[model samples]
Target: MKILKNILKIFGILGILFFFWAAFVYFSFDKTEFLKTFQSRYSKVLYDRNGELLSVFLNQEDQWHIQAREIPQRLKIAVINYEDRNFYSHKGVDFLALLRALKNNIFLNQRTGASTISMQTIKLWDKKNRTYLNKLNEMIQSFALENHFTKEEILRLYLSNAPYGRNLVGFESAILFYFDKNPKNLTWAQAALLAVLPNQPGLIHLEKNKNLLLKKRDLLLKKLYDKKIIEKDIFELSLKEPLPHFKTHKNIAPHLALKLLSEDKKQVVSSIDKKLQIKFENKALEFAQGLKQKGIQNLAIILADTQTYKILAYVGSQDFYDLENLGQINGARAKRSEGSTLKPFLFALSIDEGLISPKSILLDVPTFFSNFNPQNANKKYYGLISAEEALQKSLNVPFVSLLQNYGYEKFFYKLKYFLDFKDEDYQKYGLSLILGTKELSLEDLTQLYLGLANYGQIADLSFLRDEPLKGLKTMFSKGSAYLTLQSMKNVQRFGLQNYDKTKIVSWKTGTSYGRKDALALGATPRYTLGVWVGNFNAQANANLYGVSIAGDLFFELLSLLDRLDLEFQMPQDLFNIKLDLMSKYRYDERLGGAYTYTLYPKEAKILRTSPFLKRIYEFQGKEVDSKDENFKDAKIQIKLDLPLNALDFLHQENLNFKSEKNIKILYPKQNLNILLARDFDKQKALVVKIANLKNEKVFWYLNQKLIYEGEATSRILDLKPKIYSLFIISESGESDEVRFEVKQ
Candidate 1:
């Protein structure tokens, strides 16, 4: 008896010492370091401007934990009431509750849990076996947690780490998975449902055990009402609420959401207008479905604000899940050939250079420059057309002629230096560039159009809020951009005719070669939109072209936009002048028949001469020899009477003149080479001309063969493919010769 008493005393003293050591270690543990060493998985979230959830990127652990502040008051009350009624009052372990549980399990043969919220939080952190030793360790850790963190902080850690069935952890993830809503927005019934879920999470299937879940939830609600934590009315209403059904989360703006999520960011706030994006996405899908019936498989649309240059709505593909169409590819960012859509820029540049006015006439007849020959879209020529009319009609020949006159080098330089088109080498794109041979993305094209709408200022587009605005680059003079927009506004098409006439949209359409791509770009003073319809595989669809397909969709989108004032304000430095319709030449009505009003920048230098007289002056200056017989009677005559000031401006510029002698090559230029394909000869013919003197005879020869002798000034020659020497001899013995080659 004495030895047993001594052993008991020694054991009691050792237990007290061990308790003190554990207490010291618990108090000394760093709570922050504990949290840092613990790794809990969480999903990244994407939100739109309205704070609406766009998408959630699931982590490997399938958890979507939120911050503690995101926890709701109702949820906290429900969880505390169900899990531990005295959670706030307990110090790590509730001694009274433990005694009651021990009495029930040992003496009454009934089982009950007495683990406080802090003990459960420690258990979650350790994730160890539920043995007595582990429980003791948890008790020590729980005491440390209670000492270091506030009651609310301990509850937050417990809520964030608790498991809630179906491989989901954390209150946010479980609530979203089961109820499809945030915890803070949960109702009393929802809070009750979540409160009992963690108890038997793995064993209770929502569908199979829904009744069980409802029963447990009701009991928890009763407990809350009995304890006066919830009012009788609220408790009754929560019991009446139906069980929550599992709802799949909606992944809106999936492409953009995934793109932003890929940047490894925890949260992303985009500038997208959710309503507009949804509307445009539906429209794009419907349009693409309709086109698919006609063998077209893909489409994209982008709408941006001209003032801020921020993308408001973007549909990167018609259906991102359509594997057959390769729909995962973002068509808006893909590069493709740009057809006649770029013609307006070319005309704008020419206007800025003071090379041509809107009324300047361009030859639309069959013509060739070097080895290249261009044709109009309709395969028929209008002989001669004004620059403005050609652009409105989208005439190919007129634009090609203008590009030739403007020079390819200058246009290439402007596109590279001014705009940031750095993808293609300059040499790869040729004279066919005016016809849309150069490749460009829809984003690039939209930016260019936005520049035109913003009075020739180009700025980079933004996709996020509070992003720094890009520096503005000048693309065209204000006057030139205005003129281009004016021309585009008058474009004749089915889409434009159907829209509200009061709202002006300066727009252009492009159809790439073989109809592989269809594009339409439109801009108002407030907004800019661009759309493309094509196959991602670069397959051609004959029925799909810009005017009938892309243009129609563009107009439909325009109708959905809110009305804004689109009136253009003319700059103070621009002036209007009258021009002859037939000749496209500036004429004073005081000395002329009829004319149309045309706008020109005040700084622009206009040529003061008739088109006919200008042509004759150029011929005389270049081809007429002073010692030749044709020069003896070559005297310039002023035919039209003019105003004194106009005459003075003309005389100062040395442009008011009409030459009597017209000695020049009208067809083949000096040292020119021509390719003679089988089809080329049918579309084009060679003609030769010499100045006609009074009863003077002219002789023409090809390769020393006297082809004709005529008194007429012009003669058409039927020459075959060969190197030929053509000689023209006047009756006065003045001779000129040209050597040229034609190849098959």
Candidate 2:
């Protein structure tokens, strides 16, 4: 009995020790699996919205290793069947298979692998030489891994970490490298081929030993057929499919692909439309070629969905491979001079502030704003221009005046809310901010216009198709945005041909000072596009006019997008209002001017009357009105009948004088002596001419007396020989005077 008790005590001790050893092994896994570390080096890949591959960027290791988000069932099954048939049934280490392998090595004198999928996954982690100690360690970790993860996960880990030849790790990399296809679209033969590659990766080469690889793949397929995993017909057809040939990877949207590449992301399904990207890339190339002859060297374009704020197509440069022109520089993101692209925003703010309506008459004549003089592009101004026409014409004076009246600091602060201004110093830009003193990227300009298309709401553009939008904010009132877009619809187009005018396209063009940059931003109901054309070196070109070059490309791509037929829905917050033609206030017959219709903001108070009453000058039964009532008496009248080029001067003279907006008196220079022929039957009248008129009506006064008031930049004055001072005053109260003596 004592001996029996001794045996029971020894057995109890052994049993307890064994239980603890098993427990130790079960919890000994590294928790963070080896595949996680290996998968971290996956190549960053970009795919279009439709799952088309756009571009691929190699990982830091310079290897093709792309992790599969979801393993294909066929690939999973094929891998398991080929690598470890008992993968699902065994805990981790298949003891029966291990015993068979041991028996084969000892008795049959042949080496065999009995490592299950879990054991193989562990073996891949260390990549150590096969030895008894390493095998034991793998077996221990394999069993622990089974406890840590599901069987499917262990299978996935094996497929992801295993080498599939050609320095490519993971089934995804192999599928993409070998077949140039996504894993989900793999055929049975392709799956079987990839399945057996990891088994003896060193021996199977895609370029060599094709027959051996084929035999192994065929055997796997036969096994799958025998197990009834695939139908007989599929099995036979899969056998006929030839081995995949290595293909050169074609990169589409290379610039955007490089931009979106991140070290942490394995694969990114972007919002880009592959077809649209290719189409625009070609179109941009064509356009860039057309401009290259004119010394213009680069172009960029961006397109996005207005509602979703997802980037649809991005052409960062005309030719990404054109090294001579620095085509690799992504112009879409580079900050260039912003020009008049921001004018719409200023007009929108003006409408929101009730300072002006779309049809409100604004003085476009030359004016000074605290020593800063801004002139129109044509160097001439319209005396009376509607706000919409000013924006359409991209007149600098009107916009600068609007900024001055709107308050410089107010517009500066408001612009910050909509865009990220690189230079935060508001005082540096001042009133020039409305005229593009701020530099912006094509992306920045596009986002601003996209806000207008979205009815005053703005959101950051999204690249990832599945990424949720997070930064949407309101930038303008619905009424103001709608009215702003309405005014932009009829702006002149540069290169548009056979356009369908019924389709409303609201767009604006910009030309940076010095003509170094040309830009266009436009939006339809469905799409928003921004185009930039210029030299990367900032070299000014005569052809780099916003309305001509960039505007042409913008309309071309806009048509290519097939979105021209769509129109924005007018906001209900806008209503039609009648304003007097001259006063731009509530129309009344007493105002004595024709009335016109214009959309007005509902939130703004109605404009009742003209701020300044008009002054009428009546002479010779003809009347002309002046904003200033300090005009000379009508009884001292001079009949004002002026025609173009109808006067001859006694002598031609040149003058140099300082004046606002560079207005100059062309004929009768600064104090000069003029001699007329006394013997002539019909004496030539002393003629006065002016320069830089810009369609503005200038008052011709001889010695402080109004002589002519008509629509002529230069008036023909029929004057007798006399010493006289010629004073020309623009309707905006800017004046230039010169004196000359005419003697016979």
Candidate 3:
């Protein structure tokens, strides 16, 4: 018995000596360094499937921070009453509580602890194992800290800095998140909530144990009353407070906050409303599943607030988690061919280069570019058209010609200026840019689209909270984006605006080969979503155009959000420019070019209504000679003869129709005839139709007061026996009627 007592007394002395040594050591060092050291050991970032941020992943176990002040009086009373009744009166050691714990363990044969809040905090920081020495060291460290910090300071730091589940590590963050406000603002009910988390924050769900929270809160309140911290009335009043009345942590900005909130060691607490993430994520998954079944192997989408650009949801793929190869290749901004969707950029570029204005004339005729001659779908030339008209039709001939004229290098440089890309950005995505030949990820398109939506600003996207991205160059003039937006709203004019029947949705479709397709990284006043639908296996579907797939998908999905209420915001000088507009009628008098070829409107003009038809000529009357007889079918012949050189000149200059006065009149052949209204008014045009002798309708031209009906007998004017059928019409269906004079 004496030996055992001697061993026990020696053990007690050693413990005391060890505690004193630990206290001395802790008092000599800085706490900030200690905190930093703890962080270096553990920190990991979390992200949503769409490459969006979720939060940081930290802690081997769950813990949470709550301000000392935020902890309810009843909560504080409950913890101290159940765990250590002398908590307020003790230094870090809590001698009385330790004695009681020792008696309980010795008598009851169970493990018991008597560490004060200060000692608890000290143990949390210590990485050493939970040996007797480690516990002594924690007690010593707590004692030393007591000299530097007050009881409240120790409590504040302890509550302000504790691991709360994965990544959450500070009281300020926890209180704001849990109570949805500052720690000082936590109500009595909210304060009780914090205590429930310390046992195992993640495992604890207050909602699942409403009775437990109430019971704990009541016990704590009763203890506080017994300890004299609060009166009986106050304790009862606090008990009456609700369980979830304090703020909550439902992370609303799930996607945006994911990127913004994940960072180095520190806690990120913001107004992130993650309450709708489940619904949003589910919807996104549904879209991906639908696309996958249709062989649309890959896709990316982003949902954002229209006014503030705050991202609501981001569904970048059918299943990013399932595919190891997806989203791994594309950076935050995706890269891909823009297809015809890039036309707007070129149109704005042209306006800046002074190559052509909106009203500039463009002959939308069949044009060739190297070996690649492009044509419109309808395959008919619109004789002369304006730049706007060409854009409206998405006419390839004009765009190809315009790009060639603008100088590919110069245009590339211009694009570089707006894109302001790095060498790697270009290397990974080069020549294919202009032709949309290169592949782009969905994010890249979304960023570019952001430039369009933000009125020429390229927002610097980042994934770190408190590290705001800065210093971005302007991609384009506000006027340019504004102009593009306004012009694009006219998709209806081009007959392709059946996209969103519900709202004013402005979008563009890009189809480059079968493997590439896009339905804009576009925005209205409410939301912006960019979608890409294509075979991930590099198989292009000839039948699936960009307009039909991704475009359709985007419209269908966006319609579910709500109607996009937006208007066409036009520029100040919209379509106000002096350009060489095209004219179908040419005026060159010497070559039968009329000084004024009156094309009287169907409606009468007030100034002059007498002459309904006017045909100007370079030669007539006295000029007529031996050329009159050959007039075909007893009809009048109007012709002007010119030198062969002049004919070649007209052909070279593309002035064949310009010199109307010089074209020779032709006569109908074989069974052809004429019905001249000679006594009819010369001021009016007579509708004329002709036919072969078999009575089948044939070619005819309208002439002044001359009408020819099929199968009609030749009708002569007031002139004396005029020879008809003078112009030879061969039996082979070819006719030669040239150089006949007009006798006036």
Candidate 4:
């Protein structure tokens, strides 16, 4: 009895001394150093919105040491049972296991190790020669670590730094490397296999020691089964499972991972939806196969939630491994010609300024703004097209004419607030700005469309899952945005026409000059997506038109995402207005023209009559009012709008237009093509006529030579087969000119 009391008292003294020692170690240990060591090296990991692994960036040593919050409970149990059964009961050192190991090494002449997971974690932090002194140092450090960190945290630190085969430094890395899955997905057999790896990582080579690894893994499973931690059927099934062989980890969302890594972020929880990103990548690759035959080597796509501005999927290129196509370039951030994608914004701005309503008439004829001449895509004018039709057709002449009316400098400043541009870019692009002479990125274009989708509210795009939607500013009025989107809802592109009408899509296509860049940007109520297709080298190809190439892929990707059964809510500020069918402006009953109802902005300027519309009556080749006595036999001819064109020309020429001209040309239309026949009977002389010329005398010049000076309403002159410039000047210094071609 006395010996038992002595033994118990001696152990009590040792236990009290050890407690003080641990307390001293915990207080004296360098916590900052441990923190630095913990944070110094970790494989940058990227996770999708749902916590699925996307990609892992290797550290400087080419090893994957990813930090994780927790491991699978099964894995933790397997590890605890196999490595340290008393892991929870002990402080940091298993004294009984150490004593048993000491007895075996000294008396049984056998080498044994009894380091707990905590001691092994210390060794992993600072690799030192295996000796008694070093082991003692690790034991002291483990005491500090155990006192400072929670049990769960200590377990995490152990697994995060544990070695599992080549270049894999964590259980998370091991699962991803060996099983090609996240740690949370580990099965019973897989968890046991990973748990046994850290003890003998060097012997984990399957070719030579696979049987040895199998035996150890089965033994761990047997222990788990006996302890009731796992069922008998699981142990049997685990024994039947084959060992995992070495295989390369597949990268997910590599381009976006690289982009995030460039900002020096080691871990990223991105806004990407894993399923959506995978679907987009597969579809983009499939879409690129067809484009490759046409020399379009690469393409990129960006899809985002319209309201949140969260980037859901991003494909920087069709294939990241295609070296021949320079597929590594991130096309989403690449700056390329904007093409006609910007025309919708111009349309929206035009509506906001009250310059034109959706159905308002705009001249699509050959237009000259100073030395710059803008032509339609088909190289043929529609005479006069409605503003909605002009936007839907992407007619360059009509948009350029509208921009001219809206003022180029004003549009430039407005766009510069969101799109990337300098002060000099406006002067450089001028009227061609809306025609796609400007350069922008797919990201920028996507953001612009997102703004249009979000009632003209522009905001910065979010890549991280938790990032707040920020930098919102109004780009256009709600009424204007609704009207613009309404105009774009039914574009006549190849695939868009057959789209489901209930879920309307508003989109625009753009082809840069020389077909160097093809782009499409659009928005539904739920999503705003942008697609860019072209060669990375900026090579031009005839097959690179936006509607055919980029737009095709855009619809394919759109179909991949689930469609929402929602409709765009119209802005309350929009109201119905009766517009004259002929003039396409605010209806005036005095004009005696048919009218139709169309939506227009309430705050927008209402044009009672189109600037291009004028009413006149003539009697006996002379101007006459309706009150004139000879009005019964008066001649009626609709004189087209030419005075407005002349005034616009004067503005472009910077000439004074203090007083408007009453005399307007009526014959030999601007940019006319006259075919003079070879036969004299068939050939007719070109006739020149004027309107509203009551008492005004005018001079007619052919190629700068005066041909006629009179107050007559009409004159005839024989012209040669050549390009001729005709000019007319009234007595008040107001002048108009027309360029025509005569062919024999």
Candidate 5:
């Protein structure tokens, strides 16, 4: 009895001494070093709006650090129940567990570790050689950490630094790497599997030791069940749950993910709808694959919300892994010619300025302004077409003429100021501006389309969740925008007249010169989409055209959106007015009159009546004296061979008409072909008449040769049976020529 008492007293004294030593060490330990000692390199994570994991950006060491708040409550309980149940009750070190470990090692001849969660965290903070002294040091620092932080903070520190298999550290990286999901959204079984990973990360290979991992996970789950931490049903279900299969971590939206990650290691929430993005990506891939069979290799798409201007889907390329197609390039951002895609905006501008209305007549015939002569896409002239028809047909000649009428300087200013076009772009592309000669990114073009959908308001796009909504600027008046959209709705694929009405898509298609790029831009009441299909290498493919390629893909994507039920509401500011068609027509009695009425919106300021309607007459005959009784009541019919505008100008000036004698070709006019082989020419001498002759000698030349000379009101020229270039010259140096083919 005395020996027992003596042994107990010595142990009591040693325990007191150890307690005091631990207190002294805890006080002396530098707690500030605990935070600075272990700097975890975290991987950047991108999440969707639903807190679903979209992608993960791995750090150099393949770790992801997360905050305590980000840790799910269920995961916290699973980890604590499996790793350290007494984590919260104990300060830092659990002496009871330590004694139990010592007893197992000594008497039971078994090895067990009793390191508390706090102590493990301290060890992770300052890795040291495994020795008695190092363990002592860890215990001391663990106590110090307990004094400095709460239980949750210490647990977070453990989780942030904990290592899982395959050199991946932290709960975020490990769970995401293994399960392909965010830790917060992990299933109970998944959480249990992750709880046992840190214990044997290096040794428990997923393939080689998967069963061992499963066994250990089941055991931990049973412990939870026995302790009532988890229900019996959950425990049984978890036991039957299969271990997570290893999944290759993918960086979806690689370009955008890398760009966001480059700035910081923190998790970023993007407004992108991952499901929609995946759908668009798949469609782009499928489309590109179909095109690749025809040597076309790349496609990009952008879908944005009309109201908020948020980009919901963005596919930079068909496939990021396709190196041969240069699929890594973000084709959505690359600048290329937009072809006739810009015509709608130009027409809108014209309509907004009240220069033209949707029904205004625009000449689509061959036109020349300065040295620039633009031809129609099909090289066919449609003499007279309405403004809406011109835009629907995408007639280049009409838009070029409209742009010229709008004045290049004003249009350039509007493009620069309203749409943010650069000055260099204006200088680079001149009259071809309406033809999309200047290059623009898909992002910019989509925003412009958004403006059309939003009653002419343009706003910048938002990608990040917390980004402030940009203010909208007026790009076009509500009336003009509505009219433009109305016109675009009429545009449809050839032979598919009712497709637009069925789809209700206000869309436009563009094929850049040489067929290097094909684009389709469309908008519903709620969404705007832009698609580009072409070779990323800028190789021209004749098979690729706007309506055939990009437009087809656009409609396919639209079907995925399931927004066909939506409809565009007409703006309240627009009015429908009916006017007399005759009031708008220009009437000229001469030169084979062709009359078409011009229409204008009710709000449009009337500039002037159609110049073609004004009439001016020029009569050529013997001079008539006003005093003569026969000429007093005479009404002379005259023919004017001048431009309509010139006649309008002459009428506006109220100029008096006087008959003058001159050497002029009355018969066989300019560009007229006279075939002598016919009996008509054989019976005629091809008489050439002159007005205001003033007794001047007239010289007639055939193919630059003087064939006849006479002073008369009319001269006749007879030539041998042959093709002749005939020229009639007056002594005043005025001359006219006609090519006549004479055949017997």
Candidate 6:
């Protein structure tokens, strides 16, 4: 009875101590199964109106990962078979497998792994790398993990916890690396291949060592076959299968992905219009290939929706793919400058300052700055053209003139405020901003163009769709934006402004000395294009300057986009002045037939000319009452006695009605003089000679638009106020256009 009593006491003490030990382990067990850095680096993603991803921004220094459920079953099964076959039936440690491993390591003289799949998982999740204390901690954590998770859950943890190589630490990434597909659709053989990578990843990179990969694949197949996991025939088939040549799209910014992958845990939907993306890619590829055929090896292209500032497609290079190149890279991560593509913004600024209007004249002449005289593209000037003409033709001199006209500091301040750029940012590129001298990037260029496309508002360029930020602003006014758009259109003019009018294309071409520094910034009603063609090192200089070459390609691509309803919704807010002129003064009977007058800007009525031309000499008829300074309500009816059947040239391009083919009527002096405005220094009194009835000749002066046909001298006629060129054309096919401005 005493011995039995002592045995009971011993059992009680062991039981009590065991209970406390178990409780201690449970309390101290690490609940953290895995430590993954926050998924993204960027705070938010940029999306289009349709919620398409324009670009993903990240600032991380690690690999991107998908979740366990995000992976495929093939990978799951492959990982289990290769790493832990008894994962489904075992607790924290597979006792039977452990016993066998211990026997092999301690007695059979081999370093057999006693650590269960759970232990490996624990190490992956909570413990640090190889060390005695780490191993012990892994054991404790693994045991605790088993206490809470089921066998199946443990298997899942093992699958997700395992490192897939290349700093990608899970089944989510293993699938991406080897198969290029998500884990769910992973092939059996591909899964087997991923299973083999755990032993040694780098040596098995088939690109460098195909033989070694085949060896590892064969070993995996043998292990599976011996275990009866796969049929004999399946095992043999797997061994015979060759490695799929692995290729990857360079993760230009993997960190960018985390910031863009999700918004508030909701998976990101991109603002990337895929349809537009395909169109742009196909077109860019076609051009890049064409250039390659001609010895140009690379092309960088970006397609964006101008209206919403959504980046639709971007092809950094022609088949120029990589996996790890990030930061300052397009084709393999080399960033470059964005040239004349920056002009529209400056032009936009000009509009906001009211220093110029779309119709205001722009001079393409020699414009001097601090010892810098930027000339027209070809060092030739196209005399006094509208602001619209200067932009379409990409006249540098005129842009500089505008900058000078509107205080330079104020102009830059406008730019900085609108673009959210600092003074330093502008000083770096703005010195030559009047010219295309800024070394910027494709992404930056896209942002600026996007602002223009967004009706003068600049939206924050983001990679993530969520996360509130304040970056959007009306950098310029609607008027400025509208004017800028008009300027980029295919204008009706001479020289480089000439483009196929039928295409509805608006483009600005830019080039620097190096062939590598060429860019064509253009946009249509649908898309904006920024193409950079260049190389790394100094090769970019020459390779990039081929904008004209790229412009041809750009139009070719734009043609592929579905034809949209791009008809001009005429500017409703803008008002215009219209003049209805007539060459005919003679009536069908005597008082000249009544003419219908429909003017564009219904505001203009009285016939007005430049202030200088407002002074008319004397009347041709002595029988008529001469006009006076009080001719406020005065009206004059004059006649021209020309031979019948004589053809006459009428008003400008769209001719006005023929009031009477004989005489022109003038409004009262007071009313007419109100609209009189001009450049008095340019008004030249001309002489005209007219031969009347009975061979009598008289001399009179008249305005050019109202040429007397007869040699008239010393006469003035009311003409439209605009810049005009004096073209003296004789019978021969020769005429000289001498430019002169009539400001009225």
For lDDT, the strongest prediction is 4
Model 5 / residue 371 / CA error / Å: 2.0
Candidate 4 ranges beyond 4 A from true positions: 1-28, 262-264, 420-424, 495-503, 588-594, 603-609, 615-623, 626-744
Report the Cα RMSD per candidate. Answer: 7.8, 9.8, 16.0, 8.5, 10.9, 13.1
Better candidate by lDDT, 3 or 4: 4
Model 5 C-alpha lDDT versus the unseen true structure: 0.73
Task: Compare the candidates by TM-score and give the number of the best one.
Answer: 4
Over 155-221, each residue of candidate 5 has an lDDT whose tens digit, in order, gives 8888888887776778876677677765667877887777888887778857668888888888877
Candidate 2 overall lDDT versus native:
0.79
Give the range where candidate 4 is weakest over 10 consecutive residues by summed lDDT. 651-660
Compose the digit string of candidate 2's lDDT tens values, residues 1-744.
999999999999998986787677657666765556666767788889988778876777777776666798889889888988888889999999999999999999999889988888888876889998788778887888888889877877777778887768888778777888767898999999988888888888688788999999999999999999999999999999998876667678888888888766667899999999999999998988889889899999999988899999998899998999999999999999889999998888777777788777666654545436588888976665788999898999889988988888888877677675655688998999888887889988898999989878988888889989967888778888988898899898756657666667899999999999999999988889999999999998887889888888887787686757876788888888887666475665564546687777787656455442343466555454454354354433222121111111101112222122434566676777777554354554554556543446777788999888765655655656878898887777767788778776
- TM-score for each prediction? 0.74, 0.79, 0.60, 0.83, 0.75, 0.56
**Model 3 over residues 1-744: C-alpha lDDT tens digits?**
999999999998988986677657777657677556545444343334333224433344443332232444544544455545665677778887788889999999877777778777776677577787788778777777787777766666566555444445654445544455534455554555555455455554454555765676667666667778777787778888766533434333333333443336334433222433445555556766766666556665666554444445555455445455363222224555666666666766655555554444455554434224456534666645665667656666667667775565665665555454543344343333444654445655665666667666666432232334443556655565666666566553123366555476556666674444645445776666677666554566653456666666666666666657666464443333221112212222322322323211111111111111223322333232345553322423233333322333334346453322322222232233233344455522222112122223322222222234333323332332233333323233433342212233
Off by over 4 Å in 5: 1-40, 62-69, 90-111, 125-157, 181-185, 418-425, 495-501, 576-612, 615-744
Pairs that collide, model 1:
none
Q: Cα miss at 232, model 5 (Å)?
A: 3.0
The deviation in Å at residue 263 for candidate 2 is: 3.1
TM-score of 5: 0.75
Evaluate all candidate structures by whole-model CA lDDT and list the values in order. Answer: 0.75, 0.79, 0.51, 0.82, 0.73, 0.53
Higher-ranked by TM-score: 5 or 6: 5
Against the true structure, candidate 3 has what lDDT?
A: 0.51
Which runs of model 6 end up more than 4 angstroms from their true locations?
A: 1-24, 31-69, 73-120, 126-157, 163-169, 188-299, 305-339, 365-372, 424-432, 437-439, 465-470, 491-505, 512-516, 534-546, 549-744
Each candidate: how many clashes?
0, 0, 33, 0, 8, 66
Among all windows of 10 consecutive residues in model 3, the one with the lowest summed lDDT is 603-612
